[model samples]
Target: MSQHTLLIEVGTEELPPKALKSLSQAFSQSIVNSLTAQGLDVGAVTSFAAPRRLAVSIAKVPSATPLNEVEMWGPPAHIAFDKDGEPTKAGIAFAQKNGVDINALSVANDGKIDKVFVQIKQGGDAVAALLAPIVEQALAELPIPKRMRWGAKRVEFVRPVHWLVMLHGDQIVDGQVMGLQSGRNSRGHRFHCNEAVPIATADNYAAALEAAYVLADYDARQQRIVSQVEACANQLGGIAQMAPSLLDEVTALVEWPVALAGKFESRFLAVPAEALISSMGEHQKYFHLTDTNGALLPYFITVANLESKDPAQVIDGNERVIRPRLSDAAFFFETDKKVSLESQRERLKNIVFQAKLGTIFDKTERVAKLAKSIAERVNGNAEKAERAGILCKSDLVTNMVGEFDTMQGIAGYYYALNDGEDNEVAQALNEQYLPRFAGDQLPQTQTGTLLALADRLDTLVGIFGIGQQPTGSKDPFALRRASLGVLRLLVEKQLPLDLRELLEAAIAQHAALPAADGLTDTVLQYMLDRFRAWYEDAQIAPEIFMAVSAKDLSQPLDIDNRVKAVQAFAQLPEADALAAANKRVANILAKLDQQPSQGVNTALLKDDAERALAEAITQQKSTIAPLFANSHYTEVLSSLAGMQSTVDTFFDQVMVMADDIAVRNNRLALLAELRALFLDVADISLLVRAKA
Candidate 1:
């Protein structure tokens, strides 16, 4: 087979900047998958994405797929043929489907029985013939929610298609894609180079685009933008606050990025820095600068799509545009600060949290009570926690927050301080929404922790109470996030809070929940199940989680400690033997009509192995009971690991179902005692030790 480089490009109207990276990568991967599925061999695939294009350049692609001999297995010989070995309807059907004669069918044993098999030589299609349909399928499978039809073409796509480039080596691979004839000509940057840049070969795609003032590689373009922005910020004697999302969007927006520093009025700094940053970044798509002390600077950097002879005009225009945006933010902040945070509570009464759960104001009342209860239990300031909870959602109705939704908690923090509220209360107003996503920071203050847990608990209980719990992926209320947030707060904060107790407390606060049996257990289990994924992501084994889950523990901190302990214990030399011993004991105990009621009688220990095992269990029971109380599960399991040899000897030499009834029952009792020790931490029997 001969190999050649394959180049594919789809030129279109400006693509969405946020979705460009995903679209480009998907296009390249889909093309590679389609080719491989057709038995074509391909090498490294390079993806290119920009405002107006999505493309891929594949190296070492075969011109035509190799011929293949595929085996077609039909029904078993007994079913395909009659008793006299004559062809039946099944055999005739298989022959017709595979385009072979019924007499030519071969019978071979497929392990169990003979089956009719046919060897068909499948011919390969030319690469040129496969390109168009592969590209069409790839485009059709893009993650586009809504597609549009442009002009009178009757064709729908993410955007209007302008041109299609398809090349095999230096020759144009002729085909039609998106109602356009395939060509080697690719359009350049809209302003810098408006002419069509002809690509001579697949290898020259990136160079040709670069010559026409286009940075086709998404990663390279992003790096260029970052370097330019940082340089601009360096000259301004501050650091550029280039958020990842904003950086990617800016990279997708321009082909030739020119970073220029622009200034906003220093007076706007009086507004909350968060609101100012959100205004500039979200509204104008500009990157803000910050001083070394983490204070917002007056300067911002904006990336232009083209390189200009005089960059000062671009900077001046950006400054003019940002002044009004910053002013709007400053105005919203000033207006919101006039009305007290508490006064905003009245407006929330009209806003519904959930139609079945009542208004946002009603939720705050429930959360306020819950926060106070949690604070008392966690040794926090109850009054301050209650105050923070009551005002947590007040920012949702504020002018500043309404204008910038991302500043919901942050705006409340500023307003609470202005209202002369306690410092912790004000901080909790913002911290209530901390850890908004995974790996995000948790609440730092005790009151903040209380309010955060209370808020999530209220939403979870209320939503689940109405039977609107997250089903599959249709989590319109984000109940999964709330559940994970609750677990994270309790576990990562080391609060030692019982989730079942908190759910019960939360359920009591919901006055209007529909009567549903087991609501508390159902929600608690759902939240506990979320730990499986959390542990999986941390690289903990699935069986380790399963062992801990078998105990049906409700306290997250305790469960977390046990999981870590079990993970450590699984690595010990004695773990597999001990786990096996526990499993054997469990199987024996499960068969009994009733477990051994009496403790192991020392008089009935007839075997030396059984006596040694009984003594080991007796000594460890006293030592481990205190460890279990303190939740020192690692120490407990490690101490239990020491009894593995004695356990093995008893199981090896002793007959558990002895002829003497007293001896048999005593042995069962002894085994039960041993299993119970491990059960205090987790059901080690459920553990599957990893093989060396």
Candidate 2:
């Protein structure tokens, strides 16, 4: 078998940055799995992705597996032979099908009487023949989240599959996918090098594409974009304040990146720096420049798809296009600032937050009230919470926010401070939306924390009350995020809040609205489910969660403490045995609860085992009661662990189901008490056993 290098390249229109990462990873894995399933040995498989192309290279891949003999079992000896030990019709047919003579047949006493079987040695085919089907299968099965139908057929992909290059050493792997045939041909930069480039092997995959004006590697292309932007900024005596996310987006927008500095009218800088940056980054994919003092400079960097004949003309065209966008931003900024934030609050009365719920203004009022109530409970400053809630949604009506929706909360802080509002009020207005994503920063100030929790709790309660709970990936209201933010605030801020009560208050406030009847329970339950999911994700044991969750999770800090106690208890050496004992006790109680039980009788405890178990329980009750009262769950669980041996001994030596009904009833009651004691920490039976 000869060693060969394999190369496959899929060329298409530019792909979104977020899509490129997932697509490339899927393509790479699919190809590797296909090759392995085909009995080929692949070494050092790698993948490269650009905005317009995805490529895979495999080095030192085997052509095929060597020939090996395989055995085929035939019919039983009795069936193959006749009554006189002569050849029968079945024998003749079997021998003929296997290309052997009937005389070659014989019987051997292995286990049962064995008959003749055929063994054939087969060799592999050419590498190209084996790889073609695998490559085709991988492409057909590649996972693309969003696909489009093109041409006559409804077959969909991220984009139209224009060309495919498949090679094995110096030979082309012949195949077809989606209406296109595989070959050595791949197109370069859509306009820079429109002609096809031929690749003979994986060795030339990258270099060949580079010469054809394609940077196949995504990281290399990103580096080029960054370096060129910096060099351009340096020439203009300013530094580019590049937005990392915008750079990533532009990196995936072009195959060959060329950065050029463009100028906008100086007057546009007078428009708040945020508006200018947002207009440039969000709309135009341009990097804004700032001087040493962090003031906005009148310069921006635009990434061109291709190098132009005259760089000055390209810069001039970009400036003309950008100036109009900045001017519009400036106009909106000036127009929006004329109205005080307080006035904007009044205008928000007409903007609907949800059609069934009410207007944004109504939602803000409820949130303001809720924030004040929560602040009082947590002993935070009530005045600041109320002020923050009122101004939080004011920015939503700003012209700057209308132009850039992502800057809603951020721009509000700047505007609020500019208007001479209290510093805490301005900070809280912005921090109300803190930790918008998983692992993002939570609110830092006490006032901000209180308002943030209230705002999120209000959204969760109102949406869930209207029967609009999130299902699967359909959380349009981001109720899950709001719930998580509430959890983080409670735990991080150590706020002793009752989540159930907060949710109830929010529901009650909304209940006066037209469609909010009977929604309080459903919304509260939804919030609880979110809490359960959050704990589960944090790797908290399910049994601990069930134990703590059985109570109201309204106070997130208390729930966290309970979870910590259970976790510490679970790590003990006798934890599993104790949990089993608790489960056994619970089961006995469950059966006893089906009928009335008489109280425990000391006289019925005739055996020493029963007396010893009863005494141990009596001793543990006093020890556990004080610990549980103090919320020292770790100490309570430790006391319960001491009952394992005594409980086991009683079960081993005493029969709980005695012949006398009274004795049996007494034993069951004792077990019930023991189980009740364990319940103070966790419902240990809910813990899933480890799989082997």
Candidate 3:
């Protein structure tokens, strides 16, 4: 019953920062699953990650697993014994294979009749002995997207394994990984403190490493980096603008983080603040500083991997590396401005977006036409939309954009303004790529919103036209992102644009090819599937989307409104009962339709109950028809629910069929009308049933 703390660390040569967080999470989860599967009582598994190591500590872990018994099945009741009730060879063999005798077996009820079975007694094993191999197996199965082989056996891993620390309580749980053995020792601070540091237990891991000039806890290390960088910038009469993502990357890239301040030539600051900050953050992992007026300062702060004997030496080294990077950025920015924004439009003709499609220029032309068409339909300014579309892709040819690919759209706007282009045109150039990720900003200007939608729609139609649709995880062209972008624009902007017409016109612009290149119904279905996925992600009810989506999805905004109406209706008190009755009507009508029939004969009405149901439906249709035409789905479902009582009464009081064939046909026709009314809202049967 004794419990102990368990610690394991895998040391490696500097791992990619992007892979550290995920790798550590996977390592912790794998260890927890492995320990649980082995019947060990585990508690509080904590993980730590750095560029050189992945470590996990489990507190209050059981020292050994409890013994468990397993049941073994023998032959069937009748087959296990002969007519004289004697055991057969099959039963004896099963007992022997299970390490038991026939006399040890007994009959037990297995929720049916008594059956022949065996209960095997198992003994417990020490948890420490069991965890070594299990932990090794789990590490071997860890999912590291890309792995490499190093040294003699060339065992594969995300990076070459240099050492491993494994301990159970205060004892080393000895094991080997990739030709390296686990011990109580772990290396620290790659340069400043490279000697092996001994660890006693899981509780001592963080403090032990810290004493050796290493900070193993990622969050603590990141906090230190931020505070030091901010303090350094504050001393220079400015504040450091921290990038959370860049901070995370740098945090993972070092064990003993040392924040050092460095200065650059002030002339570099004259080359657009964005270009300067992008170079510093993107290329060097340095945090940029700005004065209170929001102007870039000449100083920046960076984290060093090691604490140097002379701190000034480290600062000078980082400055040397940053100077060339900033100089390259400045050159690209200044040379790019030499060409006017209007002149760059000509260069897009040579940039191929996709081989099957024409140049980037052709895409721009198509998007421009689609944008104007959309603007007119939405009552937006047509001139602004057209102008935005024309200049949106021009930035791809700019020198600064070529050097910093992430600044493609952004760099275009700055250069465009320098060339004296309209503010709207420059703004649209940047806004076209807005909302690149979920919850990111969308286009703020009307023209930019229109152009963004048009550009995405054109991409969806063109790629789908060529049959290069996204399948599973192989979305090479990011079509899924484009689809979500379109959905977000229409729904969030409350734009009154028709998605189906937009797709058709976008496809039509590229439709001068052979029949092999024509747009098929499959392409539109693919786009709708994307819409359904987006709707589900938004937490909307699936039945609502299924119901209204069956009618028309051309107008995405209208589809959204109808979905809201259906969701509200499904939550009503009478929704479930109405859906059940509607489903019954649907089933009966489906069976009747399968048989050949044209019209119902009124003379076949033989019972009062049947006659009453027929009259009720006719009157209800008169009231529901106008409501459906107005898209009052809530009112339509309400009236349909009111018919449930009459439907149930008719089913209970009268038989739908009579000896005469005409009578059955008339009854089926009446039920078909009831089904069609509910179908206008949704196939209500798909709605989830209410709990009693």
User: What TM-score, computed on C-alpha atoms, does each candidate reach?
Assistant: 0.96, 0.82, 0.88
> What is the lDDT, from 0 to 100, of the residue 513 in candidate 3?
30
Model 1 TM-score is 0.96
Comparing candidate 1 with candidate 3, which one achieves the higher lDDT?
A: 1
Error of 1 at 353 (Å): 1.5
lDDT of 2 by residue, 372-391 (tens): 88888878889889888888
- Candidate 1: regions farther than 4 A off: 73-96, 100-118, 689-692
Which pairs clash in model 1? Answer: none
lDDT of the candidates, in the order given: 0.92, 0.79, 0.81
Quote the lDDT for 608 in model 1: 99
Candidate 1 vs candidate 2: the lDDT winner is 1
Every model: Cα RMSD to truth: 2.1, 5.0, 3.8
Lowest lDDT block of 10, candidate 1 = 683-692
Question: What's the lDDT for candidate 1?
Answer: 0.92
Residue 587, candidate 3: Cα error in Å is 2.4
Poorest lDDT segment (10 consecutive residues) of candidate 3: 511-520
